[model samples]
Target: MFDFVRRHNRILQFILLLLIVPSFVVFGIQGYNKYSEGRNHVARVDGQDISQSDWDAAHRNQVERMRAQMPGVDVKMFDTPEIRQRVLEDLVRERVVFAAARDLHLSPTEERLDRLFKTDPQFAGLRNPDGSVRKELLAAQGMNSALFAQRLSQDLAMRQVLSAIGLSAFAPESVARAAVDAFYQRREIRVQRFDAREQLGRVQVGDADLQAYYDDPRNAARFQAPESVTMEYLVLDLPAVERGISVPEDDLRKYYGENASRYEQPQERRASHILVKAEAGGPADARARAKARAEALLAEVKKNPAGFADLARKNSDDPGSAAKGGDLDWFSRGAMVKSFEEAVFALKKGEISGVVESDFGYHVIQLTDVRGGERRGFESVRAEIEAEVRKSLAQKRFAETAEQFTNLVEQEDSLKPVAERLHLTLRRVEGFTRGFQPKEAKAEDAAVLASPKLAELVFQSETLAGKHNSQATEIGASQMVAVHVSAHQPARKQALADVREAVKAAVTQARAAQAARTEGEARLAQWKARAPDAASLPAAVTLSRARSQDLPKALVDAVLKAPAEKLPAWVGVDLGGDGYAVVMIEKVLPADVADTGPIDKVRQQYAAMWAGAESEAYLAALRKRYKVEITGKAKAAEEPAGAASK
Candidate 1:
C-alpha cells in the first residue's frame, strides 16, 4: 500500500521538488550552523519558522482533498516518509516564491486581497450572494480572519511572482508557426487485440498452487487488515454555546440605530422596451427612420395601454425581452444604460414614453411597476439582528474559551475533566477505522474521525494503550475533540482455513494471466515471421494518436509508441491482474501541412512551456540570491520532483 505514495505524482514531486527545482529562502544574515532548530519549527526559511501545526494542517488538507478526488484511495498510503518529505518541499518552494514576491514588493494589496476574500472561488464559496464573506461558513472551513488573510496574502503574492517570471516567455513568429504545423500533423493506425481475459478458460490451478501463492510475502499486504479502534470523544458545539448566550435588547437597538442605512432596502423598478432598428454609421436616413417608427409605436401603445406587451412581441427588436412579453423582471438604479435608465425612471408606473434613443437603437419605453425602498421597523428585523450579534459574540467567546480548553486537555488523563468542567457531553465514537468505509463508519463521526492527524494520534501506541488523552484535534474553527481509545483491534493475518476460497480464486487468476501472456507472445512471434499485409483477428479495431476514440488509456498509449520502423509493427502490454493485450500498429501517418495550420494554437502551447522554464530559471536565480538554511529533520527530505503548470 505504501507504493501508492511513490506512484502518486503529488507525493513524489513534493519529496524531491526542492533540489530538482532549486529555489531560495530569505532570512536574516546569519551563519548556517549558528541557527538552533526548534521543535515547533518544521523548516526555517531565512529566520522564520514554518510552524509544525501549519505543516500538519496542510498535509491533512492535501490528503482529504485527494480522498475527495479519489474515493477508493487509502489514507494510510499517504503516511510514508516519502510523502512527508514532499510536503516539506512544497512548503519550501512556496516560501521561496513568497520570498521573491517580497523582494519585488508584490505582496497582495489590501483591495485585491479583499476582492479575493469576496470572489476567489476557493474562499468565495463562503461568501453571501452580495459578495460578503460569511463568518459562519469560514468557521465551518476551519478558517478565522487572521488565518484566512495570512494564507490568502501568501497565495496571491506567490502568483504575483510567478506571473512576473512568466512575462519573459515568448516565441518568434516562425517558431510558433512551425510548432503549430507539427501539432496538426495527424496519425492513423489499426490495432489487433488479443485479450488475456478471454484466454482464462484454457488455464487451471490446483490447491497446492493456491497455498504456495498465498504464502508469498509479496502478497502479504492483500491479507493484512488495518488496525482500528473504538474511541470515546467529547465535543463542545459552538452553536450550542451561542444559543445559550442572550444578547441584551439595548445592544441590538444601539447597533440598529448606529447602522440604520444597512437595514434599508433600495428602491427597484421594472421596465421593458421595444427597440427600433438603427445604425450609428449606416445610411444617412436610418436614425431618422428608427425614431419615426418608435414614435408611431409609442402613440399606438398610449392609445391602447393594455396592448403594450402584444406590440412589444410583434415588433420589438430586442429578442431577449420579446419572448417574455417585454418583461425585464426588475432592476435597481444604475442597472441599465444611461439613456435608457433615465427615460424609464422618469415615467410613472404603466406609463408609455415618447421615442427614447439609445446605443442599441431608438426605444419605445414602458414602465411595468416600481418598489419604493424603506427602512424596516426595529421589531421587523429583531431576530436577524440578534442572530448576527450572537454569532459575533460566540466567535469572540469561543476564542477566549478555546485556550482554556486546550490547557485543560493537556493536563488531563481523559476528556472527562474538560467535558465535566464545561458541562459538555462525553461523546463516544465506536468502530472507527483509519480509512472510513461508509458501511462501517458513522456519518456523524466523520468530522473528527476523518481527520488524518487526529486518527494518527488516536491510533498511536501510547494512545491505544490508554496512557494519555489524544491531543485536542480542531475539527473546524469552533470545534475540537480529544479522543480516548476504549477498545483496540490489532491487525493480524487470517488463518489459511478462513481464506481458502479467496486464495484459490487468486491463484486461478494469476495462472490464467500467465497463460494469456504466453499465448500473446507466441502469436506475436508468429505474426512477425509471416510479415503479412494485414492480419485479421478477433476484437480488432483501428485507432490514431491525435483522434478521439473509445479505448482503454493504457492501450492507446502503448499502440501510439509501438515502433513504426516497419508498417504493422507489434507491441504487447501486461495489464497486471487483468492480463496481457497484444496490439499491432497498422500505420504511421503525418500531420496535415498542406495549408498553414492554426499558428495561434501552437504558439499558446509553446508559450506555456516557455513560461514554465522561465519561472523555474527565475526560482533557481532566487536560490543564489537568498541565504537558505534547512533545520531539524528537514535535512533528510530536501529533494523534491518539481511540478509544472499546464
Candidate 2:
C-alpha cells in the first residue's frame, strides 16, 4: 500500500482534497453560519461584541455564587431583570477597565503581586503557612494557580484606573465644616398647629359630593380593583420529596456501617513550635541559616525544658504564635504542613522534637496536648444516618420525579392529579391578585408565590380564559411549581353606590385639610402684621436636622429654610393631610465645633462622597472612550409597594 500511494502521491492528494473540501463546505460553513445566527449581541465594548449567551452564562455564574453564599435565600431575588442588567453592566465595566489598563500599560509587578497575597486580608484564606498561593483554594474556584495569578494581575491593573481618582480625592476642611454646620444648624421656633381632624365635623359632605369625588379621573386607580385569581398550586421541592421517602432499618444500618469514619471524630493535637522562617524556594544558604537557628532554639529548649515557652516567646519568628509562646492551638491531621504534622504526631505529650524541616521553614516542635479520635456508637448516630440516607435518595430521585410532574401538569387540566401522584398537597390561595404577597405564608409557600415568573404565567390570557393549569416553572434549585387558575376576576372600576362610604370619607378629609390650611394662613397673616402675645403661641422648642423634636419633616424643613437675617421671622408650613403650622423663628444656632470627633467624621464622609463621585465620572469617561454600548433593553426589576427606590 505504501509503494502504491508513493507512486500515485499527486492522485492521492487530489482525492483527499476532494473528500475534505466537500465535508468542510457541507458541515463546517453551514454549521458556523447557524451558530453565528443564534448568537444575538447584547452589548459591545472596545469593538468586541458580547452575545446573549455570554450574558446568560455570566448571570448564571453570579447566581450560583450568591446561592452558595446564602443557600436559604430565595433564588428568585437574584434571578431578576435588574440583577441581570447589573451583571451586564459589570461585564462591560470589566472590559472597559481592562482596555483602559492595557492602553495605559498598567501591568502589576511580580513583587507587587507577592506583597498583595501576603499582606492583603482578603487573600488570607487563599494563602499557605509558607506564604504561597493555595492551589487547592484556587481549584475550588474553578481556576488553576497560573490562571488565578493571571486574573489577580488583571484585576490589580484594572483597579489602578479607578483607584487613582478615588484615592486622590480630598475635601477642603473649611468647605466640609461649613457644609456640616449648615446640615445640623439648630433653630428655636414657636409653632401653632391647626389639626385637620379637628375640622372634620365642621366640613360636611353630601351624596352629590361623594359621587363627584368617586367619578374624578385623578382618583380612578384608587377605586379600581386589581385583577385577581383563585389559584391552586402544586410545589415539588427537595423537602417535599424527602418527606415522601422512607429509609428501611436495614438500609440505615448498612449506610452507618459503610460510612462509619464520617461519624468518628478525628484526633487533634495541640502543639507549640518555634519557627525560623525561610521560603522553600529561597537560596540554599538561607535555608541552612534557618536550620541553624532552629537547632539553636532546640538546644536551649532541651537544656531548660521548663523554660521552653519563655524561649519560644522570645525567639519564634511566626508572628501568629510568637506572642503566645509559639502555640498552634488544637489542629487535625491535614491542618498543618505534612512534615510538621508528622513530627508533632510522633512526639509524646510534653516531649520535644529535633529540628524538623518543612516548606515554611525549620521548626522546634513541642507536643502540648492530644484529644478526640473517638468513633461514635451505632445506636447514637442511627437517626442521623437514616435522615442522611433518605435525603440522598430523595435528591437522586428528584430529577426523575420532576420530569414526571412536569409532564403530568401539562397533560392534566388541574393540579390535583399531579399533587396526588407526587404525594404533594394541592394548596389553594384565594383572591390571589397579581403581585399579591400572603402576609402569613410559610417560607416555602412564600418563596413560590414570590416568583415573578409564576405570577406572569398565572395571569396569562390562555391560563385565565380556560382556567387551566400552567406549565411547571422552576422557581428555585430543585423546586418546581405548577399553578392552576380555578377562577379569575378582571380588573374593573367600583360603582359609586358600592364605594359611597369610602368616597364620603375621602371627601370629608380633603375638605377638612383645606379648611385647616385656610385658617392657619389667616392666623399667620394676623400674627405677622402685629407681634402676637408670647402666651398665645405654643412653647418654644429647638429644632435641627439631627433633632426634629418629633415634628413632621415638612414642618422642620419650613422652619429651617425660613430667612433668619431678621430675628422672629414668621413662616407658614402646609402639612397636607396632617394640617398646617405657623412657625415663629426665635433664633439660629450653629452646630457645635468643640467635638473634634464629629468634625473629623464629617470631613471623612465628605471625602468619601467626593471620591465616589470622581470614580463614577472616571468610569463613565472610560466607557465613552471604549465606545461601550448596550444593544438590548434592560428594564429594572419590579419593586413592591412602598419599597425604597434603588
Q: Rate the local accuracy (lDDT) of all candidates.
A: 0.69, 0.80
- Residue 330 alpha-carbon offset, candidate 1, angstroms: 5.7
lDDT of each residue in 42-130, candidate 2, tens digit only:
98877766677767766776765566556686776786778888888887777677678889999899899889879977665557799
- C-alpha RMSD (angstroms) for model 2: 14.1
Q: How well does model 2 score by local distance difference test?
A: 0.80
User: TM-score, each model?
Assistant: 0.53, 0.63
